[model samples]
Target: MSKIGNDHLTETRDHLINEIDSLSESQLNWKSNLESWSIAQVCHHLVLVEESTIKAIAWGVKAGEPTQSERKKVEQHILDRTKKIIAPKIVEPDTKLFEMQQIKDLLNDSRIKLHSLLSTVEDKSMLAKKSVKHPALGELRLDQWIEQIYLHEQRHIEQIKEIRSLYEELTEAFSSDHIQ
Candidate 1:
């Protein structure tokens, strides 16, 4: 695995932990509206995505035919929150409310699985040659799939921040109303 890819994965995971470290159970589960995902839901969705991504990468590396295609610059595209991409059913979070510790444990378990898989791959260059088809991004190499995990998490980090802001506003309004 590329050092850059590993670094990005570690960075995003740490950032995610920091983002939700102080959130209360209620805060983690509070949604702006029925249609919006709560922070807990977002974290759950990320866990699902990471697990699925690891499977895809493993499959591609083991079964895929090698190719000479270059990696696409998909970081910018993945990070663009303006474009709303619906989560696939397989990766969607359910209605379960997750405690902060639960979320962190799930995140850590997925990260461990991912790192273990990466460590076992003896030929790192093989990752660049193996390919899998992405729904929106076309064919991506096994290595690119690894990168996608972090890039996708970064997108949802922004969403988590937005949810936090909305929660703060709602609480402040509620407090103001009680004072009056």
Candidate 2:
């Protein structure tokens, strides 16, 4: 049961925070296509992933029985959903506030909360122990889960950059029309 380093989680959080800070408002709301989700939706999806992970962690703490496959599935689900959110076909663009300026702050909030929870846990010992057994991945140590978490965020950041580029290209066309 190899445990993950405490610092790894912190580092991953920092990288994600930086990624979120790089986007502008239009980029946050821009959908790449009619079937894709906007950058704002990507943020919202992350919130869901966190919520689900918290639930899985809680379950692991109590029962210690989610199977390795189940744990792997959990991590993969987070990854897939995040990818979908950041790179989905542009669904009908909805009317709403994107407020991407606040993403940096939000990521900060996420870090604070995650660290607080990690610090309070008496089961750091269990970090290496199988708190939950996944159905396929078997039982993963905390370190493995943390690694997956970083990769999941990496996918989204990549998508965020892509979304920003698309926004730029499309808006350039609009600006050109105005210039003419």
* Predicted model with the maximum lDDT: 1
Over 4 Å off, model 2: 1-5, 64-96, 131-142
TM-score of each: 0.96, 0.68
RMSD per model, one decimal: 1.0, 5.4
Model 1 segments beyond 4 Å from truth? Answer: none
Q: Give a tens-digit lDDT track for model 2, residues 37-77.
A: 78777666555454444555556656645333323454565
46 Cα displacement, candidate 2 (Å):
1.6
The TM-score leader among the candidates is 1
Q: Which lDDT tens digits does candidate 1 get at residues 1-180?
A: 888888999999899899999999999999998899999999999999999988988888788469766788889779888898889899989897888888999999999999998888999999988888877678888888898899999999999999999999999999999999
Report how far off residue 165 is in candidate 2 (Å). 0.9
